[model samples]
Target: MSSPSTQPFAMGGREFVAMMASLQALQALAIDAMLPALGVMSHDLGVDGSNERQLIIGIFLIASGLGSLFPGALADRFGRRPVLFVCVGGYVLFSLAAALAPTFGALLAMRACAGVLSSGMIVVSSATIRDRFSGDKMARTQSLVSVVFMIVPMAAPTLGLAVLELFGNWRWVFGIMAGLGAAVFVWAWLRLPETLHPEFRQKIDVRAIAGNMRIAFTTRSAIGYVFALALIQGALFGYINSSQQLVAEHFGAGDLFPLVFGAMAIAMAMANLTNSRIVMRFGARRVSHAAVIAYIILGATQLFFASGEDETIWQFIPIMTLNLCVMGFISANFSAIALQPFARIAGAAASLQVFLRMVIGSVLGALIGQAYDGSARPLAVALVAAGVGCLLLVMFSERGKLFRRLHGQVEQA
Candidate 1:
């Protein structure tokens, strides 16, 4: 393993915030950047149907998760900067391919490849932070990241809308993705320095890989964090998969779908805004624990009303907003908590977390989407079930406590 220097890469507060925001902006650019064009992509590629459009989003997530898994081990062995370069380069290439894909299968394949490549950026950014910070500092820094992360995606559809309006094609969205990937690549190449040192960099011995897998399992703290991340992420993925269809098809919102989507996203922004302030004071553990319970209760209530004669758009929007808000809070903190335990092997740990969240979440999202019965009942029930399962997983993994033992706050009591 690479021996990290005691000195962190020094940046002023604003610079650090900018770097973190860049990572989030990159991610937001990938997914939401394409959302406004989902309809156009479907028509151009001959997958011109409402349900089929989700395949575009679902497949990319599945691909990205799988892509990130290997980097964990690779990152521990090789170093951070090089892997980031490779991944960003791959993302740029594949984005171009996706923009130029001639058929439905080709587009799907490109999206999946692009997803896989992008995870490198995702995994490395988190692991890089882990290399230099831990505990309160980690949570606080991550809170800033979570806030920016929340905001970029919130703004993505608007970017896509403007682009789509100008170019009158979804391909332009991929062009933007490609352009951003290239710009970030150049910026990283010029500005980003390697954080991990040679001293602790591990060798790619098969034995070490097996050993880490064993460690991940035996380490209850790590597993608990991973499980919660996976479950909560699955719920979010389900919502993303179903949202455009639900708003337009069920609520008949038409072009105003983006407005509705943005309103709900604003709720998420509020939650992350709250998360930024709350995590440092209350700590990552307590807030994350409470948020899970809040999500479950909120989701169950929404499900109850949605299952009844609540066709009023008024009824749907506020309930959905609350559910998404809680999600925004839980996601970043749970990841920080899970990640706190595995800073030494952050790449592998992040890969495991990413894989479980993406692959499993994608599967669950597809399952729930298939159960869509014209009413919001399917999504509401799915959210509640996911939250309940996630909460239970966290409880069992913690052996009843919700706060992470990994940070050695078990005595906080």
Candidate 2:
């Protein structure tokens, strides 16, 4: 089958990549930008206990995952632009609502609503990318997009802190998010044309959506990779959920939490930049498999330092940064591998895969976050468990094979 890039695209390649990255980057902004405000938000909203405050991030993720299932089906029928517009509008509205939330519970409710809307951006953007590229080409494109996406994570906490310092209110952080949403909305409206083809549009029926999802899930390679992605996401979420407490309080970074967090994020971005340059030559399987093995090794190393009470910040930072760097290689390639069977139903496939990864992964991460005990051991343990579990799932997906490649592979219709 011909790749979607064979058709004339409305926009040029560089612009397309930048726009898609910006669409997905909003989610990163929504989450990471709020990191610096967690403690202050909890205090202002009268939230009790360190652990309870984590619910802010956890609830948003779970809601995003749960809400991911529908947008693809809707987009498959209606076209991507409408769904993108509605999702962005809802994101701006709920962000405003969250900024005005009077209680912790109310803030969580608004956050959940905002997360649900934000998920559409992810589903649509992935579907758009899939509409253009396949196999290693898709993987390379995703890596490039991620390289750009990583900038938001590196800067978000610092931006959030700036808002807090200038306004002395955590509410202004959400206000800033709303402003960012508006900018992205304008970009999408002007530049993003409908990528879904007319012939590929399916009727919006429950049975059809279910069948599409089932096909995506039951495909041997896709299922294994999807589950593995979920497991890896669990480890990332675990870090995000408790990063404030871990970096600020345990490591004594305090006001410098953003600097430490950004330093770690730079490693992941550089890994993605490298992956984009090398994946075409090495093949997605070879590159991702090697990265997973490296992940497990890094996890083990972190466990060594974390299992003891005397582990210092210097020891923990390097190993943990390597683990996240490994993720940059694993995630895009694994996703490209998993979605190889769904050329026709790329939207449905992306939606269902994202749903599983977000929902299941968020829960596992929340468990790890709640287990925090003034030490890094819980995160280290979760990291190890996630790496091993992901490796197993990948083996199952590849039928016990590792690092095998199908030369000149392309997505199947």
Q: Give the candidate number with the greatest TM-score.
A: 2
Candidate 2: regions farther than 4 A off: 1-8, 408-412
Estimate the Cα RMSD of every predicted model relative to the unseen true structure: 2.9, 1.4
Which residue pairs of candidate 1 clash?
A: 1-200, 1-201, 1-202, 2-200, 2-201, 3-199, 3-200, 72-347, 72-348
Q: Write the per-residue lDDT of candidate 2 for residues 3-26, one digit (tens) a residue.
A: 353336689888888888888888
lDDT of 1 by residue, 27-54 (tens): 5578777776788888887887667888
- TM-score for each model: 0.93, 0.98
Clashing residue pairs for model 2: none
**Residue 115, candidate 1: alpha-carbon lDDT:** 86
Give the Cα lDDT of each candidate. Answer: 0.76, 0.89
> How many angstroms is residue 379 displaced in model 2 relative to the true structure, after the best TM-score fit?
0.5
TM-score between candidate 2 and the true structure = 0.98
